[model samples]
Target: MAWRKLDKMIRPASCRAGCWRCVYGCPYGAKWTARDFIIEACRDGAHLADRARVLRVLVENGRAAGVEVEVQGKVHAVRAPVVVLAAGGLGSPRLLHASGLGPRCSPFFSDPVVAVMGSVDDIDGGAEVPMAAGLSLHEEGIALADLTLPQPMYAAFAAQVGRVDRLFAHKRTLSMMVKIRDEIGGGVGPRWADKTLADSDRKKLAHGVGMAKAILREAGAHHIFKSWHFAAHPGGSVRIGEGVDADLQTSTPGLYVCDASVIPEPWGLPPTLTLLCLGKRLGSSLAATRRAEGAA
Candidate 1:
């Protein structure tokens, strides 16, 4: 095989594969995180209170006035003329309900994932970052992300291999993760989320795994393995048109929502970029609203 040719295809910029640092953090300062935004906001006169968790919105005269938050084992009320709920899908709906809004939020879905694993002789799967290369089977509702998990992470997934010695061959072990677009049939409750895998979603996941396995085998991999099922990126519990308006304003005046909960449907992609774009748009609108109110 052509090692040089494969390297050009698989390598992603500056990322050394099989490093679990992305989980704890990126020490290289390559990854952008919310901390960066919070720091910039603080520099621009935004006040931040660490370890504060909001309990509910405080509504008066059918309008949002403030929020009740818990901090340091004590609950306190903070009053504001305009309140925004940036909590994610789960927390946002729960907060809306706790504030005496509708108890039922719009149904949501999650990215149901299953991974396929195999081994290839003389091929170091960990030579490059996981998911450096991918193929989108859009019509099939499946996407593949190349994976080469670190030893500990790989061992956890390959538990059925059942031998420490065999699990040590991390370099040769290759895997691909299948992220399928699941159905929206789950509700966000006050304290919990109730969701079940629909038959259609199950079929999609199975098909995605089958596609991944075929790719791995064609690349000289053998002794394929399949990991346990999992779900990620719970979203769409609230919607743009149904839960909030285009301006991100909810039915309650002065209350706004700007998060993944506002996504109208399953995007089959990571929501980080989407949320960042939404946040910027919401910030601009809020600034404009404040300016208008001040002029009035």
Candidate 2:
């Protein structure tokens, strides 16, 4: 009702969230993603380097001056006056730790999703986009989304069903997912994750599973199965007020860290929109800062 009152609700093409393009890369080039934005930047004269793995941020006089990256089995140093770490939550923390910037940020969380799989009579799940409709079940600390996986993925879920033929009925399958708000209990490592879900997080996930099961059953699905967990929307590593200042400046001047790494909390929502807004704000600030420095 509030969305209607504000006239802010949006119904995308096909009257759904358009999951077909999101899950699988959009062959038609219709999906809006960060790649599209980056491509536009490149067209606007921004240089893009591909496959250069940043080994560490280079610091001189306690200020970030550039980065050491490896490309094609060779190490190279890229120098710049200002260095920005736009690596995501995981990669950013790893890079910072490698550069001896800060200790690894612990108690981070990611959205872990488990899909509830079932089948309804005479329905082709692949007939339309998956997760087209969704609801925010905030009271339960979960978000509900419609789902339709490819045939092989569905088979993996039905592995214990004893009959591969029955499980192969992808068209009759009905899928939904419950994404729970997880507790922060994970630690980010330089190259690997040493994180575990908290007991509370597991309980919340179980509750979400129950909700998914109920919804599927209510929609005439039976022989319910549960898929393994997968993590998405990782954040809360180098958080605001801890790893960086509100201005996104690190202890190293002329250096900044933005992206999901600076998200202070889980948010229980997609990071795309939030990150875009943050990028815009930070871009404006950086431009202004550059202009001021030139004046000085």
Candidate 3:
């Protein structure tokens, strides 16, 4: 109601509560995005690494043999009876394709995000809880957030030193943004030719940006700006029904995927919760089955 009220308050404008439209387009500084959850997964015992990249999923004789990962230009093969692909939609598809899962096994992917930016006063943008506020506008199936950014990312976002100068010139005038889950229109393609953002998506972004700006203004923000933000969060490749069954185990038995890439809907907020929840569910289910077999 606060967001709706604020959106109404902005009149012809929309504002979300602590929707964090105060910051947008920042990856690391976004604070507590899915990245936080991934970190938690690591803390909770999921192995993660810096600069580690997966090269391919190895399949041998119709089974998930293992995987080959590249670290520092060296390929290391991690042989496992089971393999899981938790990479985002794009990553998953690319991996599956490389491994011959191809279009047949991987399908159903979505990209949902409308990026909007705002500039505020002396906020030290990246210094706070990292866009910790949000409100769900019932009419719109989405949430909002304000975020902070480092100089490097800001520079890229601004696209040049002049924009960066404008940002820092009025240092107190901090920058913020909102990311609305776009309608069913926006998505990722094999390339630019495939990547398309529809008019409805634009409208949603307009709505999202309008709301963020209004919230920032209400919060005492003086300056604001908005740009297009496509959903960086990719998911659905290796869809549940295709490469993996309902249990999240792929056709290549023993293979599993425990990440947001498999989620089937717009999360509205960060997906870490769903991913973690799914992970727990899958793990427990597998553990129980293993125990039953072992006892038998």
Candidate 4:
């Protein structure tokens, strides 16, 4: 496994107070998020309707029309020649189901994760940046990373694993995360989504945990234990070939999905960069279509 530092935007000096604002909402704007892009879009004359929720996509004569949404408890129909779904993995599939599009989104993947942690003698751990360094074993469909959770989160993990006695060892604990790319075998609906790990996925996690424990032992850590399994970046609910086309256009013309939901397979790593690239590509494709229509 090749190890390296993760690319993240954080000012360590700003976190001296240990408020952990970065974990929830960075008040200092030190961490980059979708909000930054929204701000830029608004400055470019894009109207952002905050607190609005889309109920369904409006299809007319088997073509894209617009969407029905609710804002401030009132229903409204916003008409458009094109519609793009960027509501993310969960929201996108739910919207599609509600719109009578994909009746059911089945076989999705949620990168299951677990943190293997141990107590170190002297080093302070919880105060550092989380996921600072890590390695990815692509062939094995596993990724390992150094992680330093906030005290409360660490305590929650410890409690989850029935390790209450080690809850107070946040400062002197060394933690590493083992995340596995799980098989797509779940269903998503308008109201609920369900996922279950395959046996292969469980075995992969166990192997990753063993590797993490060995590394922590080499680093002088003891009392090694793993946290309860959790999930991250749930996706593949709306896939490329099955739900959308090469240009990310759905069966309905002029309608597109540009989010993690469109990813075709189980992905082990973070999807942020992938989503950004998809968004850009979709934007360009839409612009080109608009230009062709204008010329015709």
Candidate 5:
């Protein structure tokens, strides 16, 4: 089992009991978000059109020209030599379809998760950080982790499973999550996306839940139950090789993708680091290409 901590970003002393600002928005700036990167980019001369919605990518003569954007009920075109699509897995596929680049996204995966909860006589689990420790059963396509939800969220989950009686036991509840690598079998269109779990996926989740229950029992937990299945980190819609090339470039030249949409396979784990690496690599490659053109 491996334990992850955000000690570098969050100061332990700053954390308040029952304060789950981390789940919503952190006022302390202890949580690094995409906003931080946006601020850095703006400081470095990048233009940000706040509240702008990209209508479609403009392609001319087999190359990307720019994009049409809608801002404050006004539409305008922004021209550029290179267009990078980082709208994420769901949004990227939708944009591609709107741009007439792809008819639709192929099957995709959304890591399905369920939280197993039980009552404990000691230890206030709700006060702890969620997903702090976990291990992956790669062959079984399952991952287990300690998950501590905020009281309200916990109550909601408890209520989901008709366990309203257990809602008040949030403070004494111990929770763990079972996340499964679901089979990729969903289609994404310009306006909609849907997914259904395969029998194999359900079996994997059931096995994981059984294991979690055993572990909770070992820890002296009682009144064990599970939350309904929920999904996180949807991806694999616009896959590499099928929708984009290894360089993340689409069929139209000068247009590239750098997001979860380009991930080619089912991913059951957190993708933050993988996405960061892909973004860095894409940025470097684009910068190098620009320098070459400048020199030429």
Candidate 6:
């Protein structure tokens, strides 16, 4: 909402706080993600992509060939004799279910980001490049960052009412996060189909909340908000070795997935970089096979 109010200054309570209209929703304006990377790859492939979203994998004789996808709200079927599934975490599992391939396929999704908000006269963290420059900490399934949201969203932040005033005074209050690269367990609750979020996940996020608050308090941030948000980087369904294979190919031959959807667990940091690298490898492998076939 911060970005929405950037020019109009939507709320009255917000103007009184001096936070004004800043879109801290994503501290980093560069929302460029894996989707952008895939589009570029498709562009490079030109006639190959066909710009379609596979709705069902057309499997015949169990070898897995061709697919049915929705184009401009119209379902279109294409026969390729070989198909690839790179639908990412959320859609991949559903695809499997619809195809009668995977019923027990774990939801294997992760977006466990930790949100932080503290007052700062001049937010230095937001100035960093690549959105998140460093990690507050990391483990197999946890990542921390200074998630940048717009200023307008912070209107209610100033009114936390208690010890938060000192944060702006200290000029050290800023947003930080601890994203969960959590283990895939404790199945997601209801409403996950829409948001890919879970309620139990909050417990894991609290750890980051405590740490971020302490860091800012030590850095001189007071009058801070106790709440935080966790999002971005949802995947793990169709995980390699479990749901999919090492090459990101599912049990169904010739069917491959090349996006965050294949990752079995969160990397606890920026995964797009690594995902792109993997996609590159996949593309090259596919191109090589196609070239050999042409020569034959």
Question: TM-score for each prediction?
Answer: 0.88, 0.88, 0.71, 0.93, 0.92, 0.70
Q: Give the TM-score of candidate 6.
A: 0.70
TM-score winner, 1 or 3 = 1
Off by over 4 Å in 2: 1-21, 157-166
Clashes of 4: 0
| Candidate 3 residue spans exceeding 4 A from truth | 1-52, 71-77, 104-126, 160-165, 183-194
lDDT of 2 at 161: 45
Worst 10 residues of 5 by lDDT: 1-10
Number of backbone collisions per candidate, in order?
Answer: 0, 0, 15, 0, 0, 27
Poorest stretch of ten by lDDT in candidate 4: 13-22
lDDT pick, better of 1 and 2: 1
Q: In model 6, which runs have C-alpha deviations exceeding 4 angstroms?
A: 1-45, 48-53, 121-130, 139-141, 152-173, 186-191, 194-204
lDDT of 4 by residue, 56-113 (tens): 9999988989999999999999999999998888888888888988776556888999
lDDT of 1 by residue, 193-224 (tens): 77788999889888888888888889888878
> Candidate 2 lDDT, tens digit per residue, 156-186?
7667445465577778888887788777667
Best by TM-score: 4
TM-score, structure 4 vs. true = 0.93
Ranked by TM-score, the better of candidates 1 and 4 is 4
lDDT of 3 at 226: 51
- Candidate 5, pairs of clashing residues: none
